[model samples]
Target: MSKEICFIADSSGGLPREILERHQIKEVPFYFKFQNTDYYCENVDYTGSEFYRHMEKNPEDVPQTAAPNVNDWLGALEERYVRGAKNFIVTTISSRLSSSFQTASLAKDVFAEQHDDVQVEVIDSNTCACGQASLEIAIAQMIESGKAFREIVDRVNQAVGSVTTLFVVNNLKYMEAGGRIGGATAFLGKLAQIKPVCEFIDGAVRPVKAVIGRKNSLKTMMDLAISRVSDWSRLIVTVQNAEFSEDADYAVDYLRKAASYSGKIYRSDLGVVVGAHSGPGAAGIGLVEASPLLR
Candidate 1:
């Protein structure tokens, strides 16, 4: 008999609430605090729009994210384990960016004795925000289609490599404030009206290049990302993040021109978890190749 399977991921997955519920996946929250009141990432208590607005009103008040604690995982997992899940797959943000992977892994070890049948597969998505969320959704689809545990894992691993994320920041102020860029680079970028193009390469967030203006930066990001893929016509999905109306529109208009994609394009907030790192006024595009099973 096949084992009963369930999907799990951290809040960094950044999936829309409805999609997450539709897939019946569980997400452990990452912590974020505002005005001395703490809230879990993705919790309705705090919305991306609200957080972004707060940042706008108080540019100096940069929020930080905390990894889920052992108890956070334990409490969440215990309820699910009781529901008869025999095997589990939990994916999280890059270890280089956060410690959620380690926390989840340790929690699995701690609960092994009581839930021996539960196999927790902790995946380091190696990308944050919607990029990580996109991977989780892909894996969830694989599981729901009745792929075996090992098969699903192998497919997810392959998908991870296939996944590529490229984004451009409207300004370097927030990143500079968060120390993502050096003082000199930040200063020069501000003076020159330079927009930074960033990508998750080799499991690390690095600035690939900078452009003189937003329009040029968008074109360059699209060109570079499209160049990496052999068949833009085969692209199946595109996800975007936007804080300002113009930034969102710019992403949509530019991405449409860059690739010949055939599948549905979805939009999601950058979310607080990712926003905490990427900051507001960030726009990005991620494309997932057509699944062999679907084809």
Candidate 2:
């Protein structure tokens, strides 16, 4: 008999609420401290726009984001177990990016000790935001199709390589605060309107393009991403924005026309995982190549 697998991911997965509800996905929240108050974040305390606005008003208050506590994980899992969930797949943001994967791993061991009969697989998605969302969405489809547990897990592990995550930020201040970029480089980027088109290569961010204007940056990012795939129709794509829905709309429109892509695209708000670093007015596009099993 095939296993009845329940899917769980941190808020950073960037899954739209509709998808989350439809799949019965239990997304664990990440914590961010702002003004000495710890906010358990989903789409964030006040959405990306409000958070960024607050950041602008209080430039001194840098939100400190951390992984979910292990006890929190145990409680959530036990809640599901009591209600008949015996198998679970927990996916988290990249290990290189945050301690979410580590926290989930530790929780897995503790959960096992407490409930020896249950099965738990913690997946390090090796990506964040829409990239992580795309992976789990495909996995949920596989589970719905009655795939075995081991096969689904193996596919997700390999599928991480198929996801290409890229984005362009309005400014570099947030990246500088996160220690992803140098203060000097960020200062220069602000002076010249230089938007760095960045990609997650092996779970670490690397600059892929440097366009002068925001619109030009989005176009360049789309071009660079589309060039990597042979058929856009074979991809599961997601457009995630941090207070930049209009720009994300532009990205979706561009992809549809340029790539002849006519598949369902998830429009998501940037969650705390990537948003805390990418900050406001950032737009991200993630493409996941769908294999035969996922299709």
Error of 2 at 31 (Å): 0.6
Identify the runs in model 2 with alpha carbons over 4 angstroms from their true place. Answer: 1-3, 43-49
On lDDT, the candidate that comes out on top is 2
Total residue pair clashes for candidate 2 = 0
Candidate 2 lDDT: 0.82
* Alpha-carbon RMSD, candidate 2: 2.0
With candidate 1 superimposed using the best TM-score fit, by how many Å does residue 105's alpha carbon deviate from the native?
A: 0.4
Where does candidate 1 clash, by residue pair? none
Candidate 1, residues 1-295: lDDT per residue as tens digits?
Answer: 1237777788875676776778888878788876566664656567778878887787777787789887877777787788887688888888888899899888888877677667777788878775676676667677777778888776777677667788888767777767788889989998999998899876677898889998888778877777777655445444556466576676666656656444556667776766776667777766566454223
TM-score per prediction, in order, is: 0.90, 0.94
